[model samples]
Target: MAELHGTTDDRNEGDASRGVDRTLSAVLASGALGHSERRAKLLRYLVARETSGEGDKIKAYAIALDVFGRDETFDPNSDSIVRVEVGRLRDGLRIFYGECTDPDLWTIDIPKGTYRPTLTPPRVEPVSPPQPAHLNRWALIILPILVVLPLLYYAMRPAPAPEPTAPYPVLRIAVMPFEAAGDHPNLEKVAFGLYTELSLDLSAYPWIAVVSPLDPNEIGADYALKSQLLWQGDNLQTNSQLISLPEERLVWSKSYSIPTTVEHIQDTQLQITSGIATSLGSENSISPDLIVARNARNSKPNLEGFLCFISTYRYAVEPTRTEHLRLRNCLEDAVDAFPEFGEAWAALGVLYMDEVRFGRNPRPGHDSWAEARAAIDKSLELAPLRNAPLMAGVVLSVQAPVQDLERARQLGRKLMELFPRHPPTLALIGSLISEFDGRWPEGHDLVQQAIALENAPPSGFFITPAFFAALQEDDAAALAATAPLTTRTSETELLLKYLAAARNGKTEMMAEQRVLLAQKDLSSDADLVEFVKNRRFHEELEASLTSQLEAAFLVKADE
Candidate 1:
């Protein structure tokens, strides 16, 4: 019977492979290939290798030899022709799939790092368009009912018996159901939302493994996070605690108050969730004491990877060539040790891009852009929905040597669709779209959404709005926008201040800004102009920035 099952499985896979082959033939014949003989041949060779069960063995050397007529002397390190052609093939496949109306067909992709093609069948049904706001009122009407049923079911279910403690270098923490401290309308829903959202936010940190429906047996998780929600006037307060399992020792605790209006219950939930997640996982904002202690006691590869990521984030905050090289090596090691770590791959991509930004690509003959693109692609493939990978992809698409405006827009759309309320993605993508793509109105709307989402956004978030105000010659508006960003010491911040000061005719302030900018490396007129141009500001605003920098430099030169 076992042999028969194996035979049946193999037969099914064979049938699928045949179907995929047919689909590939159809794609090749279609106009989607656009008469590119090279792309067509490349696709054919890759599919043939994959269908023959030699996908794992497919390599650039093999492709160059078989398809590109490269001699045995072909060197993949020196010659990027194979990689270039494969990229075109990927673009061709994307076009084909975009035009493909057949939902039943398999989609082919030649993922980075290898020439083997992956043929994946569509697993998800197309989502139907959402009903209008008036129609969605039905969902709101039934929302309380939906919320109560789940609570009732959970309350009645017998508690999971505690299991034996599981060993771990990677710690597992369970999120138990949040308890309500007092009777309040919709308090049950709020508690449920906290439990769900907190679990999701904590899981964003790749080093920590999160388990739900806490097993009392402690079989999988070493720690448990508990929360209590209560009403305080118009505000909702959430008090959270983390306890070591088995020992039942309190490890960490925090209290948060969120103003909850009738219309903003969801926002209240997000606020509470974000607070807890940041305190527990964000290494930069709040020291996650538990994670810090655990890693100090027993430093493991995954923990090291997380630490490397923290270092990477710091480099973003305060960039230096020394820190850049160190982070590059650290992330490279982390990825090599644990290839599946998506955060590490994302950070590695960022470091690669930073090297290019600072004009410090360490490897002489290698293509850093290609390396960055590959690392970013791998990260997205590993963790598509995560903020880090998405942000890295967005950065690459816009800031890399070869900008992909379409890809940037696609990533931006995904961020808005999946994480509409996420402030970091909103602010970063909004700024990029506005500054790089010149889609100011749409981008500004996203930036406003981010501002509304977070009370105290970082100074970077204000750059685009300030620039826009300056462009319109609204000096007051520009100064008001730049006020919050005064504490920042970056070149960009100094440039913003210079622009605002110049607009207001504050000669002293403008001189101070120039001095500050010079300290940050823009010392001369040529240097300032080049720096502004290197920023690749949108075409509409580039002339204004160039003119401003040129004028400032001329003043200093005359002085």
Candidate 2:
């Protein structure tokens, strides 16, 4: 009889046929049939079944048993073997289709119910004849040359190496505000006079960055410098003093209390300023008498100017009109006494900006912007590269005639580079970026680094970490981070307690906060505003605490 071919007569012929191609292809590809001979035999058996197509379900199971023989019972119902083989077969078909271009040579089809194969003649396509070997000899030789040329070029080319990095620059410094400690009423004034004069003398040095005595807190305690002059005084007697630079191993130990008379004060200040310059090995030493005479000539010595510096520095940390006025008066006197004081002018500019920011100084009617610009301009003229003047420019760029975010960013970056590990610089930049620029994560990181550089001090600095943490909405983290420093019985602690309790869902903690608020006499809106401004809690917490305290106080008043 001629070879019989399979027909799709059963209800599930397509399914079976599809499964057979997939299964046979899988078994052949898996190398799981022990030998190539067995694999080939199994494939042949599957193909034979496809072509015959005469087996009923029972006949199919019997054929499977016959192929396996009695050595191992065949299992038609075992899903583990069938699924694994089917997966392999599907993968094989995919690979074949991917590699083969002509579909007419042979095709694998899975119909509905039958596992079978059918043979058909291959379709042929017309093609051009191959060229003679002698005609292609030169082409073959040139093909190798083309391939080798690329290889040779690649071998000869140099591989690029990474660029070398530059080392961090070294910093120089000088410490000031070496106020004397003493019992004599005027002794402390004399000590401060010495500090001021010495600082001025040191400022003449082109390389030295004189540490201003205006606010010791803002400059930070930790700094690396080649030299430092620590001017300290005995609290009991200003006449007794010690001027020392631990790095230089030098000390100017002295005891001389001058009366508060104008002459004595001038003489005292002159002696110390010139003496410090000589001790520091300065080539040019200022004479004590000249220093005294010069100070006497400017006898007022701009106390207002000094105060302005202090007020501006304080306002930087905690802004207020009272402080602004204090700064204005000081700067005015400072400018009068010393027209060349660039820092004072810069500070004046910043003070005006503060006024404008707080709405105390109007824009159109008030000449605050003009005053600020003029002051900053004069400051820059005097000290072109000074940090104070540069910072003034940065402030103006952000708050004055033009708002330049890029300039502000550049100034901040340069400042940090010049004064690495400077806490106030870091804090200011971090706060600006965090609050105005919407770069919260960077701001938060910068502020946290600033706090770390500050050595985690218990004072106003504690609020840095707390503020950022609250902004991030990580109240528990904020509480834990701030717990150690918030122990002092101040507004800081009260705020911390309130936030910790509020976040922890502790009603009792809130009640305790109420009690503390009452004890501290934080009843008025002004007092509350100050408290809120100085604390670590967020606005929501501040509002909640204010309301709770108000209610609790009201009830107490009724009783």
Candidate 3:
């Protein structure tokens, strides 16, 4: 590699020094980049090194050791604090100066794949996009058993059933007596049949408990499902409404009309049950009947482990008195109960990251990050399917402090080949598309494929497309991507709205969402992440939002 050169003594050194100082001051003053203390330090450290004529001495390892406080044996492959921060700093610098800094002033850059800082006078020419910061030649694909494991989960079992009384308050549904109105002969039979089907379908959800022939006093459940049946000409019409208990809030209501035949009743009930269960927070595509049947005959040890794994997965993503203890206990219980549960180990790796990511690890008695890293390694060793561990590794690779991007990119390609149309597969790789790798086209395509694959994907599925659009400054595309989430009132919904409105210069819409965010008590990006109820959505969204927040599309509105 060529050493970086500067003409300090020969070419306006005093003026250049003053220009650098002025620029650094502007960068640190904005909420755009300095919100992250490490980013600010990275910029300052690089600028200082350049000013002192020590740019050639700057290396990835040195930055890792000196600025980021890494130890002597810092590994570029595993601990990527320096790499991720450098990438952010580069992007932030462009966005900050593009919006706030003067055009005639100096432009400073620490180019990708190197730590050397370059300072140059303003030029009118357009610069080519920088390369990805940690681009390494990806290792050859190693097909592992974890490949297509998400598909295997389809074959494994349907879903959840435990005592309704767990420590956590679960979503509950009480299928009240389906009333038959006027000329509704054999209506009781239809109502009873629908009740049985509803009970079975709703019970399949891991977080949902069902109460049959619900009594009025069952206030403990979170929600209640009620319906009325009417004969509409040559058809049976089932009108259903899901209501929140105690609060009496209308969650969702729908009407379904199908032919009054045994075949239609059976098939239509399944469809309606599936729809209702989904609205109640079950995002898994598996039908409720499948879940009910699977849990009924699951092997004891495996079932115990699976239950703990699902619970841990839930607790990790969504915030709820969340301190990482409950998730840790759940994963520990899974591995202790069934030592062969590799998915549990993979999830444990994510939870260990939860400590560092969420401030759960301050001054640890143990090396939690190392332990977390080992968990994924063990998961890869033991997992019968590769997708679970591979996906977990992909998440770790995405600016997560100890990122493993090359390995993740390799695994992502393998998973993409194995399960092209799987929602999870599309969701994972699609969210990772970046200008850095020139993968945004493929990434956006995958997200679109995922959207096409599922008729009713979760609200989080729209997130990746919207994010990619925002970062690219395609405000129209960003608005188009978030059209699906407009009806819902979620933290993510509010976030996308704020982003779209802010980027589109829809000042009134932006102001409206800002109020909604305050109502949700989400004060920061971290707060928005904590409110994430979807794991796939959270990891990918968190990965991109940091840089997106620093980009030029958004305007600061009057408070």
Candidate 4:
């Protein structure tokens, strides 16, 4: 590392220091680096350390520990998190200063191969010859008029009406009465039964409103789920398709087949209905997919409130500071515009809880917990049966400072009884019990059932199995369980792979996992421990896993 060098005698050190401070603040506030909180924090930390005369001692390990929350076990040789962030920081500073309006602003730079940041005071520009005295007077007179005319026009003009708060129209899905291909006496009854069952099952989803026995010309429904049943070689076959009503486009289609028998009749109905509900309404389902797709091309203001749900869904998938702020603002606006929108309130509650968990609070003294509890309360009061509010209440009960695991369990039981066919709900509650409460076999069974119910299971459906496998010390089973998530780079996926590899003595694979884990902004073993803690696991499992990881990876906690 290099020490800070003194500037030339052209300006006093005090002037240079003040200029650097101003420049740092401007860059930090600027949007040149997009909204990456990691890069912003890195920039601020580096500048603060350099200015405080700690530049020479600013090693990668120290940077990781202080800025990135790494523990003492952080090994600069193995972890590239510090180096990768510094590289990005260097590029971001170049772009910031390159597009700067004030070319004379002092800039901070982390030179290649060194963690120490160098501050370069802006060079003095050659002075232009003074304008003529009459030209300066005329320019001063014109400039005031230019500014005052705009201000006076604004002051004189009538204030426009506030944009009407358009109610967020929940996406409506109508389950069309099914048509029968065969003329069996029971076929019409079976088709009607399927329609009724499917509609009732889909109503459990919080994201969409469900309607049944839809008329083909229904005006309000956004999507139509049409199904047809027939006898195929002594088996009952049900075919279904989801169509976007406005565009009349087929969004998704599927067919399910089951043995034809008196006992199999209800099971067949359940099979087809669970598939449709999971495909259309579960997490990572077609509803959010359609909303995101449409919102990409359409920028009308009416749907902004509607898009808040989509923002929350996307943020849950990939949590970045930018996404968090965007979702938070969107949800806030949504609730403010329509206080009675219980779903939006529920989503807002979830967002607040996330702010607490992720440490993404917008400012000091934000009291995210209080905000979450209030939002949850309002949502429950308004939409008690809605999934979002119910789930939010369940989550808050467990995670808040005054823990209520029993209340969470009660809410989980209520969800299970209410929405037995809802796959994501089942998986979530199952995983919550298994991981948070350490109820192993029972919770694991529920997740397996959820998997069986889903046509296209999400990665979350497999997490419980992986955890179970890891606990059993069956690394191969754990790896196989998480195979569907091979392409994902989430911290959970990396941690699972690391655990599997480390436990099985797979040095080559463990090293590969370490390389990726190192890039997750986690500097040491304790950082991973904190990540696990954020998952809100049961105390027993958390302590056991922490110890196992420490021993398996040969990493020590910071003293």
lDDT of 3 at 472: 58
- lDDT (Cα, tens digit) per residue for candidate 3, span 480-558: 6676665334665677777777667777877677677776666655565554422333344445654444441336524
List, residue by residue over 394-428, the lDDT tens digit for candidate 1. Answer: 99999887789999999988766655444566778
Please provide, for model 4 over 88-137, each residue's C-alpha lDDT reduced to its tens digit, 9 standing for 90 to 100: 46645655675566776886777555888888788887899988787987
lDDT of candidate 2 over 104-134, digit per residue (tens): 4344432222344343323445697987888
In candidate 4, the residue pairs with backbone N, CA or C atoms under 3 Å apart (3 or more residues apart, or in different chains) clash, namely none
Clashing pairs in 3: 145-385, 145-386, 146-385, 146-386, 146-387, 147-386, 158-290, 158-291, 159-291
Which candidate number has the best TM-score? 1
The TM-score obtained by model 4 is 0.47
Measured on C-alpha atoms, candidate 1 has an lDDT of 0.66
State residue 510's C-alpha deviation in candidate 3, in Å: 2.7
Q: TM-scores of all models? A: 0.48, 0.42, 0.40, 0.47
Q: TM-score of model 2 relative to the true fold?
A: 0.42
How many backbone overlaps does candidate 3 show?
Answer: 9
- State the local distance difference test value for candidate 3: 0.59
Model 4 segments beyond 4 Å from truth? 1-302, 360-362, 555-559
**What RMSD does model 4 have?**
26.1
